[model samples]
Target chain A: MRAIVLASRPVGTPSRENFEMVEVDGEKEKLRAGQVRLRPRWFSVDPYMRGRMNDVPSYIPPFRVGEPITSEAIAEVIESTTEGLSTGDLVRAHLAWQEESVLDARFATKISSDPGMSPTYYLGAMGMPGLTAYVGLFTVGHLREGDVVFISGAAGAVGSIAGQIAKTQGNFVIGSAGSDTKIDELKQLGFDAVFNYKKSAPKDALRSLAPNGIDLYFDNVGGDHLEAAIGSLRNFGRVSLCGAISQYNSTGPTPGPRNFEGNVIRKRLEVRGFIVSDHQDERVAFERDMAGWISSGKVKVLETIYEGFSSLPDAFLGLFSGSNNGKMLVAL
Target chain B: MRAIVLASRPVGTPSRENFEMVEVDGEKEKLRAGQVRLRPRWFSVDPYMRGRMNDVPSYIPPFRVGEPITSEAIAEVIESTTEGLSTGDLVRAHLAWQEESVLDARFATKISSDPGMSPTYYLGAMGMPGLTAYVGLFTVGHLREGDVVFISGAAGAVGSIAGQIAKTQGNFVIGSAGSDTKIDELKQLGFDAVFNYKKSAPKDALRSLAPNGIDLYFDNVGGDHLEAAIGSLRNFGRVSLCGAISQYNSTGPTPGPRNFEGNVIRKRLEVRGFIVSDHQDERVAFERDMAGWISSGKVKVLETIYEGFSSLPDAFLGLFSGSNNGKMLVAL
Candidate 1:
C-alpha cells in the first residue's frame, strides 16, 4: 500500500520535500479482535493539518517525522473482526494518509448508504468541516436572527457553510475572499455583500458594506482581517475564532489586532476561540440540519477535488495559496 | 464657586497646563423643577476618565474642551426641589469637577447614612469600581470555585476588590503589580501569589507562580501583561477585559499581544470586554454581597486620598505613574 509520510518539518511555508510517499505492507499485519482493515476511498486536507506538522504541544499531537500523516478520511471495511463491522461496509474515522489502515472498529463510524449523497460528502460538507461551520455559527458565535455577520475566508469550506447557515436565520451575511471568482461564488451563496480581500482592505470594504457595523464576525483568516472585524463590529458583537490561516504559515508570532482592546471594551464585544472537535455534542443537530439544508437546496456543496493518491500533498499545500474553493479533497 | 475645566486636550499624556481653575456663578441660576443643588464632598479619579478626555467615540462621551470633567462622586444635596430628595441628604451621582453642581435629582442615588462606613466608600469599594469587579468576575468571567484567577494591576481599585472577592470564593488568586509595597499589600490581602511586574517580566513571573496556568484572567492592564496572561491560561480559560491602562496613554495604536492568535485558539480562551454600566442588573446582588463582605472585614477597603479640589488633576495623573496604592480619590 502507498502512504504519505512526514519527511521533515517545514520552517515556514510547507513544500513538497516536507512529505514523501512510501510503500507499506498493509496485509502483513494480523487482524486482532475488535479491529477492522480499511481501504481508504477519500481523504481530507485542511488548514489545521499545518499545525500538526510542527513539533509542538496542542489539543492534537503533532505529526511524527517518517510516519503517515493521519486525518479524517472515508474508508471501506475490507475485513473485520468486530461485531458491528462487515466486509464492504463504508466507515469514517481519523485514519492515516495511507491506502490501507488497520485500526480499532470503535474509532470508525459506520456510514449508512445514502443514494442522494455522495460518499465524498463525508470528507467535506457533510463531515467535520460542516460540523465546524454549524457549531461555530450557532453555538460559539451565538448567531441570532437579523444579525449582520461578516465571515473571513468566505470561499473556504467552513466559512461557506457558516455563511449559508447564518443566511437561513435571515442574517445579512458579508464575506471576504482572496479571488474574484470566490467573491462571485460567495454572492451566489446568498452573501449580501462580497469583497476580494486581496484587492480591497477589509476595513475600507466593511466601511462601505456595513456602515452600521457588523453584529458578529466569523473569523478564519486572522491578522488584519481580525483587526478590521474588531473595528467594524458594533456594541455587543461576537467573534467566533475558528482558524487563523493568514498567520498559520508565518515563521514568527503575528501581531494581533491593534484595535482589540479599545474596540472590545467600548463595544462590549465577545471573542471566543473554539475547535470543532471540542463540540461533538452538537453532531446530531449538525447532521440533521445540514442534511435538510442540503436536500432542500438551501445549502449548496462545493469542493476542489484532486484525483490519485500522489496529488494529496498538492491538495494540502493549495490551501495556503487559495488554490481551492470550498473543501479541498483527494480521491483515491 | 470654583471648577476645574479642560483648557485643551492632551496630545499623549495629560499635564496641569490642560486644566484651568475658573470661577463659576453657582447661585446665579435658579433651581428648576426636579433639580438638586449638590455640594460635592468626595470626587473620583478613575482610569476610565482618561478615555473621556480624548476626542473619540467611546462608551462614554468625550469631555468638552472647556467643560468640567464629570465622574462618579459623593455629594450632599444642600437644596432640592424634587420629591424624592431632601435637604442635607447624601447622594452619589456623576458630578462635575466643581465645588457646586446643579443637576437633575433623578441622576443621583440617595445614600443612607452609615456611621461605621465612610461616604467615600461609595466612590471606591461599594460603588462603580466595586460593582465593576463583581460584574467582571461572576457575570462576565463566569468564575467557578477553586478556579485559578490572575489579576493584572492587582493593587488598583478594581483589581484589589476583584482579588479579594475571588479569594472569598476559595480560589487561588495571583496578582501582578508595579511596586514591592503593592505586592506585599496583595500578599496581605490573601492573594496566593504576588509579583512586582516592574522588577520581573509577567511571563516569567506567571510561569513560576502558576505553573499549571490560570483559569480566569482579570485584565486591568493590557499589553505585555495581557500577552502573559493569554500564554499562561489553561484550556477553556476566560479573560474579563475591564481596562487597558497600560495602553491608555499610548499616543498611537499600541501593538497588541504577539502570541494572541495561537494561544487564544489553542486554549479555547474566552476574552470578553465589558463595562459595568451595562450590567446594572447585577447592582442589587453586588451591593448586598459587597456590604456584607466589607462589614465583616472580609474585604478591606483601601484608598489613596488627595486633600482639597486643587489636588484633583495631580491625583488623576498619579494613576499613570502607579502612585496610588488602591483607589485614587480627591476629597473636596
Candidate 2:
C-alpha cells in the first residue's frame, strides 16, 4: 500500500515537490482483537490542511515532516477481528492519506445504509464540511428568519449548504464567489444575491445588492471580503469567522481589514472565531436537521472529486486557485 | 443660568475654543404640566461622548454644532409641577451641558440617599459609569472566579471600577494606565498587576506580566492595547470591547493589528463589542451587587471634579489628555 508524506515544510504556497509517495508495509503489524483493516474509498483535501503544513500551534497538531498526512476518509472494511463486525461494512475513519489502514475498531464508525445517498457524502456534506456550515450559520452567526446574510465563498461546500439553509429559513441570503459559474450556481441555489468577487469586489457589490445592511456575515475567504463585511454590517450585527483561505500561505502578517475595530464600537458588532469541535453538542440536532433538509431537496451538496490517491496534492492546491467549485475530494 | 454649547464640530481633538458659554432663559418655557425644574449638581464627561462629536452614523446620534452636548447627569429637583412632589431631591437626568434644566418628570429617576455615601457618588461609581463597568465585566466579559483579566484605561471611570470588581470576585486582574500615579492607585485598588502603557508597549508588558496568556480582555483603549490583548489571549478567550479611545480622532483608516483574524481559527477566541445601553435589563441586578460591594468597602469610587459650569469643555477635553485620574466630572 502507498501513502503520501510531507517532504518539507512549505515556505509560501505548497507545491507537488512538497509531497512524497512511499509504499507502506501494512503487514508489519498484525491486527489485534477489536481491530479492523480497511481500504480507503474516498478522502478529503480541505483548505484547512494548509494550516497543518506549518509547524506552528493551532487548534490541531501540525503534520510532522516525513510522516503521513491524516484526514477523514470513508473506507470499506476488508477484515475485522471485533464483535458484530462484517467484511463489507462502510465506515468513517480518521486514517492517513494511504490506500490501506489498520486501526482499533473504536476509531471507525460504521456508515448506516442509505439507499440513494452516496458513501462519499460521509467525507463532505454529512461530515465535517456539512457540520462546519451548520455550526457557523445557526450557532455562531445566530441566523434568524429575517436576517440579511452575506456569505463569502458562497459556492463552496459549506457556503452552498449555508445559503440554502438561510433561504429555507426565509432570510435574504447574499453570497460572493470567485467565478461567474459559481455566482450563477449560487443564484440557482436560491441565494437572493450573488456576485463574482474575482471580477469585481465585494465592497461595491454588497453596496448595490444589499442597499440596507448585512445583519450577519459568514466569512470563509478573508482579507478584502472581511473588510467589506465589516463595513456593510449593520448595528448589533454578527460575523461567524470560519476560515481565512487567502492568508493560509502568507509567511508574514497580513494587514487586517483596516477598519475592523473601527466599527466594532460604534456599531456594537459581535465577531467570534469558532471551531466545529466547540459545538459538538449541536451535532445530534445538526445531523437530524441536515438530513431532513437534504432528503427534502431543500439543501443540496455539490462535490468536485479527483481520481486516484496520487492526485491528493493537486486536489489541495486547487483550493488556493479556486479550481474546485465545491468540496474537493480525492478517490482512492 | 448658563450652558455650554458646541461652537463647531471638532476635526480631531476637541479644544476649549470649540465651546461657547451661553446664557439660558430658563423661565422662557414657563414650566408646563408634568414638568420639573432641576439645578444640575454633577454632570459626567465620558469617553463615548467623543464619538458623538463627529457628524457620522453611530449607535447614538452625533453632537450637533450650536447645540448642547447631552450626557448622564445628577441634578436636584428645585421646582416641580409633577405628581411626585419633590424639593431638594437628588435625581438622575439625561440633561445637557447646562446649569439648570427643565424636563419631563418621567425622564428623571429620583435617587434615594445613602447613609454615609455622597450624592456625587451617583454620578461616578453608583450610576452609568458604575453600570458600564458592571455590565462589561459580568454580562459582556463573562468573568469567572479565576479569570486573568486585562483591562486597558485602568485608572478611568469605568476601568477603575472594573478592576476592583474583578479582584473582589477572586480573579487575577491586570490593568494598564497612563501615569505612574494611576499605576500606584490601581495597586491600591487591588489590581494583581499594573503597567504604565506610556512607559512601554502593552505587547512587551503583557509578555512579562502574563506569560501564560490572558483569559479575558476588557478593552477600553483600542489600537496597540487591543492588539496586545488579542496576541496574549489564551485559547477560547473572550474580549469585552467597551471602548476604542485610540482611533476616535483618526481622519482615515488606521492600520489595525496585523494577524488579528489569523489566530481566531486555531485559538477559537470570541471578541464582542457592546454598549451599556444594550444590557440595560441587568441594571437592577448590577446596582444590587455593586451597592453591596461599595457599602462593604470592597470597591471604591474616584472622581476628578472640574469646578463650575464654565469648565464643561475643559472637563471634556481633559479626558483625551489623560489629565483626569478617574471620572472627569463638572460641578455646578
- Interface CA RMSD of each prediction in angstroms: 0.9, 1.2
Worst 10 residues of 1 chain A by lDDT: A112-121
| Model 2 per-residue lDDT tens digits across residues A148-171 | 999899888778888888888999
lDDT of 1 by residue, A256-314 (tens): 89957888888999999999899998889889898889888899888899999999999
What interface root-mean-square deviation (Å) does model 1 yield?
A: 0.9
DockQ of 2: 0.76
Candidate number of the best DockQ: 1
**Model 1 Cα shift for residue B326 (angstroms):** 1.1
Best by lDDT: 1
**Every model's DockQ:** 0.83, 0.76
Cα distance off (Å), candidate 2, residue A316? 1.0
TM-score between predicted and true chain B, model 1: 0.98
